[model samples]
Target: MAGYVCPVGSSSPHARSNACPPGTFSNHLHLFDKSQCETCPARFVCTRGTGGKQKPPVPCPVGHYCPPGTKYPAQYKCAPGTWSNRTSLASEEECLPCPAGWFCVAGAHVPSGRCSPGHYCPDGTRTSTQFPCPAGTYSTRLGNGRVEDCIACPVGSYCTDGTSKPTLCPVGTYRKEQGAKVSEDCVPCPGGYHCPELGTVAPQACGAGRFSDPGSASCLSCLVGHYCADEITSREAMLLAMVCPAGLLCPEGQAVAPDANGNACPRGYYCPRGDIVRGSVWLLLFTILSSSGLCFWEARVESVLLLESLPALGCLIFLLWFP
Candidate 1:
């Protein structure tokens, strides 16, 4: 036949050249039936041959796939991010990427699954090993199809695992450093400062003479009868209480004192209540002077003065008689 070739190793002259078999082909015309035909190998095909020559199998080209026993060029192409290697790949399923944590090079006979914890692999990767996710990025899943799978750490969160999602920084804590990988990377708000919410980059300082508890949202004024020293931290403010001097008067919510040392009673003044009021001092002085017979002049002075004066007048009369 014009388009047929004899099979290889056939000894009979009557054996006519025939069309190539599904898995085999010959390029030479008038070839002895005894001539050996070429067999298609995996991932390869032998679709065309001349009448007088043997044809070599052609490698399956890119964008097309050839299964074992294929006598013609493949009509199917590999799926995106997938590849096949070697001849005789029977199906598209045979063309696969290295499993999670591993990588497979082009034409690889076996997949590599040896990637370390911090590394990852994408589909159709040709390297024998995986590449690391870049800083500030992470991947928690295995067998990532591409670098795009690596996720960026959120503004308030941290990520460590190459194949995992990021974690949020806790309340009262902050992380200024980029690409923080763990909660430990977050710093606690300092004393006298407040970190009200999560992911704070810096703590907010309490206002002057004001204090806040740790992680407080707002600062508190010093309590009544209490004084907050300047620049005092929250912890110190809580323990501080203002005390008035022994002799001075102190009222609630007194911030500045006209005389912090206290108002002292004058030397001549007797402050019975420890206060310098004029009424108490006068009342005390009057009571003391009137009780004694020291007042000699006015009847309004007292009973004691009357008794003593009468006795003195009688004595004077007796003295006059004796004279």
Candidate 2:
């Protein structure tokens, strides 16, 4: 009788008190049962009261749901990474995180679906947009959960766009630097160097007696009358070696002839061999002369008298024989 309250229309001392209905409470002490009870508002909970007093309605706690007519606090709880839009949610299923390729903030009712191609999103993200992968990195998959999901571009390779894989440098090209972002980042191999394979980091120098054109895959042998003794780096140097010097004969693969001295065979000299220095010819000449001389006086006088005495003796002998 002490905890009970009488009705408004019945003033009798023996009148019985009526209990408050569910979702509503009455807190008037020593009041009549006809007193108007307060109903719990949305997202609030109320329970039956005793001793002619009613419990005040309380707001719903976070992660816990309360319906419009909730009478108790032990209703429901939202799942992790999920949130409720408004109070008085009936079930935990109403709370949902952002979908794939999207981002959602805490307690967000709608997801931000404008994630960029080079970025990633995780559940329950509070930011309006996704995070971008760092330079020299890529994210091929969509809706990546963390920054670690981005991969690094390999050495000697390039990645131009976001969310793409590494591409190998083409032949005749090289990339010594790291983290190339485009195909043009690959440099052309210098002239007289060889770049035979893909993803070359450095160009190889041409071998001895071999030359290469600019951005060539392989080195070619020097042509006749041309030579490349060392790593020729330019076309001008190769062309200078290719020309044959005057008065000198050059064969294949030779830069200079051994017998290329500037001197030639002398005049009236025959040189049959190609080498004039080693071959020469000489000619012979003959001369004839006529002269007359007289004997000395002593010998010449004796010889003249002998010739006259012989003629006189011959005449005398001829006369004596005639007498």
Candidate 1's C-alpha runs over 4 A off are 1-22, 26-37, 41-43, 47-59, 63-171, 176-179, 196-199, 240-323
Clashing pairs in 2: 27-54
Clashes of each: 22, 1
Candidate achieving the largest TM-score: 2
Candidate 1 per-residue lDDT over residues 1-323, each given as its tens digit: 22255456655433434555556655545754323555655677666442233346676764346776576655555543355545455567767655554565444445544444445665555453346666567765655555666777766677765635666677777666667767777776665677677667777776555666665655666543334454535655444433333334333333433253444433432222212222222111111133443422212111011112221211111111111
Model 2: per-residue Cα lDDT over 1-323, one tens digit each: 22334566655533434555556655555556534655656676665442232336666665457666566665555553566656656556667765545665444445644455566666655443446666666766756766677677676788754545568889998888777878888888787798899999888998666777887888776654344556653455666644433333333444332243632323432223222221122211111112222221111110111111111111111111111
Q: TM-score, each model?
A: 0.40, 0.42
How much does candidate 1 score in TM-score? 0.40
**Candidate 1 least-lDDT 10 residues:** 314-323
